[model samples]
Target: MTKVLVLYYSSYGHIERLAHAVADGVRQSGASAVIKQVPELVPETVARKAGYKLNQNADVATVAELPDYDAIVIGTPTRFGNMAAQMKNFLDQCGGLWFEDRLVGKVGSVFTSTGSQHGGQESTLLSTHTVLLHLGMVVVGLPYSFKGQLRMDAITGGSPYGASTLADDGNGGDRQPSDNELEGARFQGRHVAQVAAALASANIGATL
Candidate 1:
């Protein structure tokens, strides 16, 4: 079976919810979904005080294991229009994978959450794509085929780049992903899984 890794860093609960939704979509496409998380970089005291959802239950993804996935979908909250430091730190550890070209040809995609509607959602996704491209991965993104991407009548986070969510601008953390946002996330996940499966089958046929 094609394997997909849904990896993310969620300081709060919003992106965590998005990650699971994306995983659900991956399963719908008949891919095996392995949901994992990057290790938190925050101090224990700060994490406890801020109530970070450490997600102790999810497996910690190591850079060496990245090559095992046919597809990888990553997520993070926006930090100055870029990925959070923790996610970036995790990716930084993949230098060995990059040197070996282990991630080449894998389907890579990203998602993000922001504190405000116009927050760095798209920018964050784009920035992550840059890293994926550098790793020689075949980057995938949400397309217009998902009607949710076209719905302007409602407030949501989604673009041709990747899935996103607005998590309350005032740092309230009260806002959650809207239905449209969740739909967009699922669509991206399913699309990536389907594409990865096709590529994997093609490679197998080539070998045969």
Candidate 2:
């Protein structure tokens, strides 16, 4: 069976919710979804510097284990118009995979959550895709043809670039994803999985 990796870093659990939705979509497309969370960072000092936190349970796998998946879906919380440092650090460690071309031709997609509607979701998604491109992965995006694009009244997650979410405030009353946002994420996941499967099949045909 084809496997798609749903890797993400969530500080407030919003992005994690999106990852789950994406996984659901992948499973609906007949692909196995492997969910992985990046390890948090630990600060050297008690002052809590720029990017540091403790990750209690981190995955202990190398890039060599990454290529086993047919596709990758990454999620992150937007940090100052970019992905969180923890996610970027994890991707940076995949240099070995980049060198070996392990990710070449594999389909890749990105998802993000932001504190506000204008909070750099697109930039965060594009930033993650930059690394995927360097690794020669085929990038995937949500198509305008998806019905959610037309029917949603207040869409906080649908983007032509990838999936996204506008997180709720500190009051704990605004974190829930709207129906449109959820539908968009599901569509994004299904679209990426279908594309990855088709590409894998095409590559197999070419090999024959």
Candidate 3:
């Protein structure tokens, strides 16, 4: 079966929900979805006040193992209009994969959650795509053809860049994704899965 990796980092519960929606879409498209979460960075306040550990395991898979997936979908919370440091740190270790072209021709997509509407969702998505391009992966985005586009709120989630969710950060509760945002994420997953499956089949044909 075609396998799609849904890797993400979530501090709160919002981005996690979006990851699940994306995985559901991939599964609906008849591909296997593997969800993995990056290790979190314990804040200094938490370490001092809550007695939390500052650093933890760093033994996550290296980029050489990325080829195990037919496609990859990544999710992150927008951090100053860019991917979080942990995710970037992980991607930076993919230099070997870039040099070997292991990710070439594989499908890739990005999703993000933000504290509010207009809170740099597009920027985060674009930043994530930069690493994918360097790895020679085929980038995918949501098309307006999907029915989810019509129902999204003007102020909340769903974008042509990729799937997005507007999360409430206690300043307001109204910015969270609507049902349409959830559906849009699912659509993106299925779209990438279909594209990856087609490419994998073509590769098989060439080998045969």
Best candidate, TM-score-wise? 1
Per residue, candidate 3 scores C-alpha lDDT tens digits across 1-208 of 9999988776655777788889999999999998776766666676457543333322344455688998989888899999988788788888888886778888889999888778899999998999888888889998887766666345557778898988784576535466888888999999999988998888941232
lDDT of 3 at 128: 92
lDDT of 1 by residue, 1-208 (tens): 9899999999988888899999999999988999899999999899989888765567889988999899999999999999999999999988999897888888999999999988899999999999999998889999889888777797788999999989995566488898889988899989999989998888942232
C-alpha lDDT (0 to 100) for residue 138 of candidate 1: 86
Error of 3 at 195 (Å): 0.6
Worst 10 residues of 3 by lDDT: 51-60
Error of 3 at 53 (Å): 15
- CA deviation > 4 Å runs, candidate 1: 169-173, 204-208
- Quick one: ranking by TM-score, best first? 1, 2, 3
TM-score of each: 0.94, 0.85, 0.85
lDDT of each: 0.90, 0.78, 0.80
Q: Which candidate leads in lDDT?
A: 1
